[model samples]
Target: MGGGDGGDDSVLHFVFVHGASHGAWCWYKLTTLLDAAGFKATSVDLTGAGINLTDSNTVVDFEHYNRPLFSLLSDLPPHHKIILVGHSIGGGSVTEALCKFTDKISMVVYLAADMVQPGSTSSPHDSTMAVGEEDIWEFTYGEGDDKPPTGMLMKEEFRRHYYYSQSPLEDPTLACKLLRPAPLRALNGADKLAPNPEAEKVPRVYIKTAKDNLFDPLRQDRVVEKWPPSQLYILEESDISWRRVITLLFSLSRLPYSLIFSVLYLFFNYNAKLHSWFDHISSLVHYIKKSYC
Candidate 1:
């Protein structure tokens, strides 16, 4: 990624949240593109997803996923503002984070996200079902299920239909390697996130994937209607070919490794600067925590 603009004093921080069955790796391509465009992008993994994966039993709630993001946001650069971009179910997490750290955020971009309304019992979209007839995957909800149930794994055949159907062509190996059982609690959490008037006043962008099987075009339109975005774009129409898709997916999958190595490099080569920054942020975090309490 390119360095911050030397002339402009204002620095932009982009925080990306991925959708269901996806990790931070999915934002790899977008991060690269944003970096080229002179913005700093950080693709985050929810508590139970991506590099944060631990025992499934431990990640059975929404707060579990939210805390990690909160911790990350708490330590951000004081001079920079954040732009949160959430895809699919990630929108909810972004919404929750925004509620807590509204002062730190500048904008929110929902890419085919689940637009939840306040006091709504169900999510706007049926997250369990696949999009088209070509894709057949059953999302089973147990009896008396209030929050989205956990422990459900996607069938291999269904995975082939939905994710790998478009890109990787007949190559299932890449898709299989990327697949993992997503935490159901994150999907079914009861916390309500309606359109905040304050948030609506800020800049919001929505990017719709035209060929998406999970989130249909009509559903996306409904989301846009309820939470009108400042800007919209169609990915497939915007020269986003199959090769590009593969490249993007590959990059998103590798973000954790990149972040790890980046931290290691900083620790070894710039330990003093990194420590100084951490100490500064620690004081800020303490102040913010006390004030909020």
Candidate 2:
């Protein structure tokens, strides 16, 4: 997906937020693809992520972790709107934005991400998190020697099995090196998310990774069952691997500037049917970017 609009006067812009243990670097591949396709994309490093280097231990709440993105969004030109895409725990960040800046967002995309219900407790064994093959992985809470109620880090050995299992081409060694300890308290907070009265008015789309070991197909369904977005697109992980997953999500990158009501589902129903939709989406995005930029 083209993530940026290249400062095109009328083109669409995308703000990408990475998931837990992942920094803005995780978005490099997708952002590069988006750049080639002509969209202006920006990936933010929340506190303690990417190159930001905020100590994970100091992140006491979501506000600390979410400030970078929130500050970036605040700088956009008036009348400017964005398609906010969040992956994994990043979902909670975008969801919070949806409420605070309702009129500024065109759409909210949760990509195999957490859709946290404010003021609720979550359990892995609960129906919401139980949909996956979660048993295959082991998790450790807090940084080593750091007390309880801290960030969480997955075992490096299981990184490939859980995080990148759906993307077979992903080099676990490379991914492992980039992973950092996530501020668990930031992701698992007890504070209530600001209720967005306009949430239903804004279009929401969820793209599910079918074979996701971390968030199995059933787990994704549980998220959908809770939030019930405007539409759902399922990407089958059966023999598809990373290429297929990227292709499915890429379709969204190209539609940055389409009219919200007119373009919400332009690529939705057909994503599962067209294996090459990624190419076409890129072409369309280039055309749109060219026209506006």
Candidate 3:
């Protein structure tokens, strides 16, 4: 993904927000790819997530968990606007950012993420919805079992099936080792954001991971229908892991700027099909950025 627009225009910076139970570490491969292509990328570890050193149990609400992101946006250069990319529940963080820093963000990209609309209290696929009552993970925050869960960590046995069913074996292996307990209240119990017309003015893009087991594909369709994005692309048969779905997001260059479509299944219909499409998709890396920036 070589990302120069053939001119001296300001380089497009993509600020990546990872999903639940994840940290800045998850975006390692994507950040490297963007940097090599001449684009700037910063992946922030939300409070208690990644290596932020905050305790998840103490996180009281969404605002508290999202403090790091708010700080990062607050400190940006005045004229520089970033393309905010959120994956899974990270979409909630993106929405929070949109409400607070609409001007600093040029576009919001939701990758297999919760495109929670205004007035909605929680994500379409919150922790409870994603895991259900199955003994797939453990939830605790030092409080008694009677109280609501404050943090959660997925069980190793169920991790592969839910999050990385379609990804390479190594991807899930790495995630299983590195995944941390996410703050439950911070992710699911946020108060509804008051309507902000400015947030609507900013362009939004939703990239669906059709094969994602955690966030149902049908729910993704409903989200798109509810708040239609400027662009929508679906990664067929790809799981939530970047190893399988990152190429599809990186391949946005092939799409025409003026074309706003409902659904486009662009890559990896089956195993071994991704390489054939990569050559074409990677040919141009800054189509959307070049047009927008």
Where's the lowest-lDDT run of ten residues in candidate 2? 260-269
Residue-level lDDT tens digits of model 3 in 1-293: 22444444444568999887889998887787666545567999999989899888889788989999999989876545477988887888888899999888877888888777666554554532454567777888557778888888877888888887976888888888878888887776543677788898888888877767777788788888877888787777653233433444434533443331221233223235655554544444345457653
lDDT of 2 by residue, 21-80 (tens): 888888777677556555567899999988897887678788888999888888886445
- Compare candidates 2 and 3 on TM-score and give the better one: 3
Q: Work out the TM-score per prediction.
A: 0.68, 0.75, 0.79
Off by over 4 Å in 3: 1-9, 121-123, 131-133, 239-293
Best candidate according to lDDT? 3
Query: What does the lDDT read for residue 197 in candidate 3?
Result: 80
lDDT of 1 by residue, 83-120 (tens): 78787778878877877777788777776676554444
| CA error at residue 72 for candidate 1, angstroms | 1.3
Error (Å) of candidate 3 at residue 221 is 1.4
Best by TM-score: 3
Report the CA-based lDDT of candidate 1 relative to the real structure.
Answer: 0.60
lDDT of 1 at 224: 74
What do the candidate models score in CA lDDT, each in turn? 0.60, 0.66, 0.71
* Local lDDT at 240 for model 2: 28
Cα RMSD, each candidate = 13.5, 5.5, 5.0
